[model samples]
Target: MKPEPSSALFAGPFALATLSTPDGPEFPALVTPDGQALDLRDVFGDERLTTLDVLDRWETALPRLRAVAADAGPARTAVTDLRVHAPVAPRQVFQSGANYRQHVIDLHVAHRAPGDERPEGERRAEAAEIMDRRAAEDLPYVFTGLPSAITGPYDDVVLPAWAEKPDWELELAVVIGKAAHRVPVEDAPQYIAGYTIANDLTDRATVFRRDMPQIGTDWLRSKNAPGFTPLGPWIVPSESITDPDDLRVRLELNGETMQDESTADMIFKVARMVSYASQTARLLPGDLVLTGSPAGNGMHWGRLLRDGDVMEGTITGLGVQRTRCVAEGAA
Candidate 1:
């Protein structure tokens, strides 16, 4: 909690979060803008209702959630007093890679192999040209992520011993509201339930199959480790965000700002990414679509994550997410 003001926790009139008391089971909750968390078990009239269940019938649940948020009684508890968890347990995760215009160019130049002594300016110009062509002709580079990689916003991220170059990629996560199959980009918005934040942690050492160069990137090995994706403190309704393309996505490593870019830098916007994903597979309620991370990852700055590092990430209108890095076998 760090004594940060409640206003920094969420935006709009209200947001949805998963929370639990010290010894109680985790449950869905409606969090007011002022930080009061009202458990939705009684409101839903079912103790077994999870956030996924609420999202399954988002159209019907929205009105009820709004009504509760508007007049949450004294039965609510302060959010600071409860243990926060990931907003929802997603069944599927679609992650977009190299989708940021500037981020890709930066990665291209920074990751030059040994003995490649081309000037930085020339390398950057070449990278920019490649990015421009990709935007014009190639579809977004989207990959599937395991839901097991997800962890709470405030949870500890255990950096495995094998991950020698762990890095951070803060992104805007699109939470699906309805089932979508082969949907058009124009109709993608209707399937969106809301938005949240996700930090897609990667291990640079495992990024490529060094033994098999033709295999290229290995996302599953580099990014799907447990606690690799630190998710939301809450999910802000899509209506609350005036423009998903205009939000600011920022991340700080141990109190130092590292990634501070805008969604405008994304090569393929949220709607297009979602629509593209639907073309290949059916998107169900509670599925997460992670828009690519903007520039300024640890590799770009030569400052990979280590034990005891703290990452604080926030997206405009979505809430703040803070996670502490812990060594795998730490006490």
Candidate 2:
């Protein structure tokens, strides 16, 4: 028997709206331009949707979305008019580091190499300068954070008082759809759910200062601050992205272009990073992997974000996001 077709409605970047079902938000898929939420699980449930499961289904989902759009008539203005939210509200956000050769060079010039091991006093004195200088050099870097830091589309990023140097990192983030660990590098693409844009907010001064041996902890303290990571506006299905690695990324501050580059600059590519990370831990559905950012950050200009500063970023084909920086004490 022919099965009923499934659809999705992805509005405002990462906002995903699925069809109403007895199970509740069936498929929980990403929204589309035509006010339809691609019902991933439903599509997988139906034989007519396709034989492929979620892991390998994206390749087929694109055409399916277009077909649905054709049947729906011209897309509603609301789908194109809404704001985007984080592609996936995951349990955690994994960020990369020193992944770009240029970023490594910048770090070397500002701070010592990984093994250089500078003296305590010297390291402290150079911390701020290193962050400032390194920000100028668009070297590849990575890191990870808890899910609490995750913010939805159009959410404001709070600049804490302890953060003397709050900076922005505009990056491409990947969402995991399948449950797989230690997946071979060649097969890494099979585990992906979709993609989105992310702004990795950093507390530079606090991070370096806490790196001191006297602190007595291995983890970087600067990373734990509240509202550090702002993500979303939308989570674009992998099928929607023709070439994930080739997309162009841009960052604008108060209407001024601050960062512009393509994902082609990545030093560690997505497949390798996914394969590497999965080897140690499970990369489950809804997990977020943030690809590193390109050069051109405020830290490089010695002009970290101030209260009320508007920051925006966009990726070709995916979508754009704008955020306002609120002061620590503001009501």
Candidate 3:
């Protein structure tokens, strides 16, 4: 029971997507600026051509895609009639943490010791100063994510019974087009194929290991649950975005605005994040690099997710994805 967004999903001449009819096999697709979607089989003339295959041949396929968008004609289908899936099935997922200046500052201020009563202004200032130093002198913190956790953008998010504090984290996802290993920051853009939206759900209750305090956060349990990451309706080509840093990242909970911020608040920008990740591991085509989420998560507001809550997320030009929260084992 999802509603259509107010505007076109993406304003680009064309974008990449994965779609299928009810009970039909998923296939790579080309989406027009007007919201018409055409299966890429027409372009590839091969049933085996998948979304990742298209990404693997992005350069050779770009011109063909543009031509198709200009003349979709009779082959076009309205996007509403199709079941959209996550655009690419990545072999590897690299996610950034505490990458937003305000998000970290807010979290630091909010989680102060119970008995220690520092003035709000003073606490925020101290956190802000620390963030500034980290931004200037520290490397971006990144971690791995499981591809099995990815679900379709509009899918249901089942809150596990054991998860006491489930939360939402809407972020911009970067799709790799070229294989990059130890790539320089200036050259990171060439390795990026496109951008998509991802909602990185977390179970805050499992974030810290109470039994082994020295071991610190338990990301595997806290962040990698099945269907924890809801990703994409489409992959908007990097060329379509004039300035990724200027885009707005927003999310609404049951029609109430929750997380709303600009990419400008990021401590580590897209290019830098990609370059940093590449220095440690090779980034292959279709792999995803998730920019950290912005401030205004459920933890910040002291109101976590509940069954039947609907989360609608949107990144400027990348489109919107609506996910309903369902308690585990609900019919």
Candidate 4:
């Protein structure tokens, strides 16, 4: 079971959401200023007011939504009264790879390939040097993930039978609000919609193809599995978070703290990641750019996911995600 958060919700600006219900269809709602929620249809007097509707007009809708939230007092529904679903259905997902200092360093020292015969200290130093050079010379490493892999924050993660080692990667996901192609770092923030938390679950056993080493990594087979990415409970506006580079990302597995690190550890920051992503592909509204996962993955802890295990991931103000793991049946 996931424990309740210690902090309050009204301290900042959060966006709308689509809710899950038992009796009727899913509905869109606003996260009011008072931490309560209001039906978007009622607030806007338009039944077609979906979270996507709000996102499509994010720049103009923000002021109006903020006003509604501010004025929404006693009449608002308690957030606890409704079950929250994924805030928005993203059109695309871009994941960063080997972008964390500690994470990559850990991998280098752990995997004793032909060249990894160096001492642990030497390996750490080498990895640090490599990151420094990459930041100065190389562009960010990114790859596409199927949007269909996304699921609700508190949903169950059904582990496929073919996956022998499923790992958890808690990352800060940036949601784009506008289109950008080949954008500069200075102008990247203008394209951002907000921030959300995403758990980029991966099948470690299939990351690299054993049969065909020359073809490189098989990210599609290792990643992109259904319900592999668990997204937010809410999306905090870009303005709400003062510094994207200075947030804490944490994940606890089955009541034990596993991955806990600062966003400060990212090799490439948000602006650079967004800018680099737009260099080739056109980044449209509602697309997700997942900043790479920080240190302390399952590989570092020597334990991968299993049935009935609970993963609770929190990224500063973005929100918490509690995903219960279950094994897939042969049926």
Task: Please tell me which predicted candidate would have the highest lDDT against the true structure.
Answer: 1
TM-score per candidate: 0.97, 0.71, 0.96, 0.93
> How well is each residue in 241-282 modelled by candidate 2, as lDDT tens digits?
777788788999999998888888776778777777787778
Off by over 4 Å in 2: 1-30, 34-70, 73-77, 80-84, 110-142, 209-211, 214-220
Which 10 consecutive positions of candidate 1 have the poorest summed lDDT? 1-10
TM-score of 2: 0.71
- Which lDDT tens digits does candidate 4 get at residues 1-331? 2224334552275566777455756677777444566787776678766776777788888897778766736376666666778888877789999888888888667655565567789878888888888888866899999988998888889999999999999999998988889999999999998898899999988998878788889999888899999988787888888889999999999989999999999989999999999998999888899999998999888899999999999888776789999899722
Cα error, candidate 2, residue 20 (Å): 14
After TM-score superposition, the amount by which residue 254's alpha carbon in candidate 2 deviates from its true location, in angstroms, is 0.6
| Lowest summed lDDT window (length 10), candidate 3 | 1-10
Q: For candidate 3, lDDT tens digit of each residue in 102-148?
A: 88887778667557698989999998998899888958999999999
Give the clashing pairs for model 1.
none
Task: Name the better of 1 and 4 by TM-score.
Answer: 1
lDDT of 1 at 222: 99
Ranking by lDDT: 1, 3, 4, 2
Model 3: residues >4 Å from true position, as ranges? 1-7, 113-122
Measured with C-alpha atoms, the lDDT of residue 159 in candidate 3 is 91
How high is the lDDT of residue 309 in model 3?
A: 97
